[model samples]
Target: MVENKASAPGKGSLLQQTRLVCGLTLFTFVFFHFLNHALGNISLSAMNWGQDIRYVVSGKRLFPWIFYTAMILHSGLGLWKLAQRRTLKMPVWEATQIILALLIPYVLIKHIFVTRGAGELYGSNISYQHELTALWPNDALWQSALLIVVWSHGCIGLHYWLRIKRWYRRVQTPLLGVAITLPLLALTGWISAARRLELSGNQKLNVTAEQKSNLLEIVSQVQLGVYALIALVLLTLVTKYALGMFQQRISVTYLDQKTVKSVPGPTLLEISRMKGVPHMSICGGRARCSTCRTLILSGEASLSGPSKTEAQVLKRIGASANVRLACQIRPMTDIVVRPLMGHGKKMQAPGLSDRYRWGVEQPVVVMFIDLRGFTSLSEGKLPFDIVFILNRYVDGVVKTVNRNNGMVDKIMGDGVMALFAVESDMSSGARDALACIQAVSKELEKVNEDLAAHLAAPLRIAIGLHGGTAILGRIGLDGQSGVASGLTALGDVVNVASRLEGVAKEENVLAAVSMDLITAAGITPAQNLTERSVAIRGRSGPISVICLDETAIVLADFKPAS
Candidate 1:
């Protein structure tokens, strides 16, 4: 019940930060390299111009050193990550990027050694003309394959990095344009440069027969080394899987109902896939998207602190210590977790699992309204009369809440818990909560007139309103919502609002409003308002409750008074 006291951002493990920096730098270099190829689409001569322009933009040896360093560091770290991974169960895009990155050094090593090595070993400058002559007709397929590998790898990495940003939505269209256009342009340029050099018949790299033989030997050794590296990787994966079979399996309980069994080899997200458990994951199990986050209820001991990437994700979601990304959580022991989303689905939603809807966290205004003294007043009334009066109260609360775009969360005997801002802004929720209270007050006044003979006095209600983040969902849990399920929320903020309603009688006020709701609504509290530091249960500190009189209510604009 205690809230997560947000402290300064904890310094997460440095591995992911270093990986991101390294990957970003390599991606920048790859982008420029692709752009250079794209220039060939204009002309082989244009391609030469692009090379000059590139040099001018990225000054001399300084840029080259940084580029090569980043490339080596990124590649090395990637292999390290590949080796350290507890599980290979990942999203398709993430898997694609890893596969391409690993294959890059193998597919690309021969070409680099042939071109750059010529200058170093043979003391000969390899020009664009020679490159074109060699690759045009004979090795065109190789060139295309390398291009596909590197470009796709870079694209997927950039997408994962940028798509999480707040500004990504604004630039989504422009990014899409480049994503579709660059590949086409780069391929055209590569072919054009090669074709032009072959037609001109000006491509040749002169060397002695002994030098050629040495080059052939070097190439063969490099090729064999690549084979060895790939074989090593395969050996490692098989060993891990084989050992895992003999290792211990663990059980994870989802809520209190479903239990999934796994061999501690795959992550919770991966286990969900294996067991056919429906879970919400927008970014495939990649840490880039935090949708696969789950709340740990009774198994904190079984889980460890998150990895650097998972820490970053949790920070982005404003998640507490109890929450973790299901994709990143691989428990060594039995655990209990609850999927926070996948409830209250509408028929119009997308994806294969259209049956369940996604839940969301948002600022909502919670208003609890209690019919004052209705329980005592109903004691001597006829059974039908009590039912009639309760029905009237329920009708008023429902109509007022619905008209203001709010939903009645629950109705117990003599009170109602209503929620606002499930699909709207927090400010709107605040305004609507106040409006509903006012409307219900008017409705009760009419009810008093209609039942003047049957009732001893006019009906009065006590309302308490507070606003903050609430997790909105639709589920039938603990018999809270009826047999036919309905939308609901559970949070300390809502509990505080309900508690305030219970204390309204002690304070001798009709309605109690928290300053948070007033601030969110941008409303000015009246000068005549009664201020009290009311201690509410589940709250760490006392809330400043402001009670408004009838006159103050009519004139109040939700703005604070000077």
Candidate 2:
């Protein structure tokens, strides 16, 4: 069920490669960061290699500037994108990612200033061990924070990429298990370093009593600052949540403009619920339900990618790379999307694309064929039997209409509304009208033969054909499709054709008539000997119509003007 849209450069296109690159870049950064942190526990030497690599880039003097510049630009661009969308209604996983992203810069600044700048400018001579000893109690908070951010963000991006590849679901969990377990190992290594520092008290060098006291005070102040910062961030989050409750909760708008607005910090399901959108959140937004799916139309770069939950579910659904659960995508920017099911809806809210608009032309013939005595057949038959017969009859009629280049626009029980393209020069509307009548009569005759005596006798059909410049357009209820007409039909041509077919039941004939335009278009009745004036509905005077019966009308009946 994949739909391919034209991807050539156009005014409104869905593809944007830069976003993909940005997302990939961020994910790569996180993955490497976590892998290095995890290595610290293996041995001080392994940790040294990780630091050596960082030093190669961050301390290269000439290249360090370039590295710093790139990081600033990439991180800035990612943050700027996240800020543009005014809505805060993101899934829980996404909201957490954004919070962690904001914290990363601040946390990393302390790290850089202490290790690199403090040692260079103040002559503190801070090695990784020196900094750990000075920081005291050797708390692993920074280590834990950094590890969580790197693993979660990296795995999310990987999950998203894997979803698009074949067999993503089959191996996603085992892969996820590795991603999760590695970080825990890294955390354990950091904890081990803290324990070793306690055991090796001799590692600390002699210092004055005053110097030691001052260091303890400095560490206490920094710890207090960190806790205060965490408290403030929590307060801000609570305030945002409360405000979201009062205002129309943040909603995500799709390319279709169908909104999924819900509580300020809604799970994907809640958002879908608030907006009356049909989202298949099979896992209940627990990342367990891959059914609440979405294909990101934009801002994929700003996203952190699928979380562990999303990855598992996407694997279950066998989704494409771009496809993800609605629960998984917490856009920091506006996105356009087409729900696989809701693409062709009627009366879509503003800015939503209604691709279902069928642009039919005017001055065409409209024909309606009703089966006589179909009601009686339904009265005695079972529901299934009635549907079976109805389907058979409708299929036969639809095939007949389509064979002649006419559209079987709608079917109501045993009735069918077919439209012939008046703008088409290949065939005249009159000829199409006549062909429709012949096709229906012929199809019913075949059906009567096959059914023999089991059917409700032989079905009789009455066809009403109206040919004029009729507006052939959709006539449907709200959010549905239908076929209908407007009033102006050059004279009573359509009315007469309809009335003529009405008399068909009594006359026991399948009849067709020609209008001035039909005749002008090279379509003439088989026997257009005379025009008889007949009274028609909604007209003040009698209308003259050309009647064609019994004989087959040929294209020769109409001749080109010399």
Each model's total of backbone clashes: 9, 11
Best prediction by TM-score: 1
Model 2 per-residue lDDT tens digits across residues 477-531: 3343343232222334445556766655554545435354355445444445445
Report the lDDT tens digits of candidate 1 across residue range 1-562: 2111212222224665577787788778777878988988777777777777877889744776787688777776777667655556655677899889877876577676666666579876556665666566877888888988888888887776664333354467888798778877888888987777778777675546676567767888987886687667767877877897787788888884589777885778777766667676765555666667889887787777888778876886689989988878877788888877652231122331212123445567888888888878887899999998888778877888899889888888878888987556677677888877677777878878777887887788888888887666555542223333566776778888987887776676778888777767767676567577888886689988777545456535455434
lDDT of each: 0.72, 0.54
Superposing every Cα of model 1 onto the true structure, what RMSD results? 8.9
Q: Give the TM-score (vs. native) of candidate 2.
A: 0.37
Worst 10 residues of 1 by lDDT: 1-10
CA lDDT for candidate 2:
0.54
Candidate 2 regions off by >4 Å? 1-33, 53-67, 123-126, 134-138, 167-171, 202-276, 279-339, 342-562
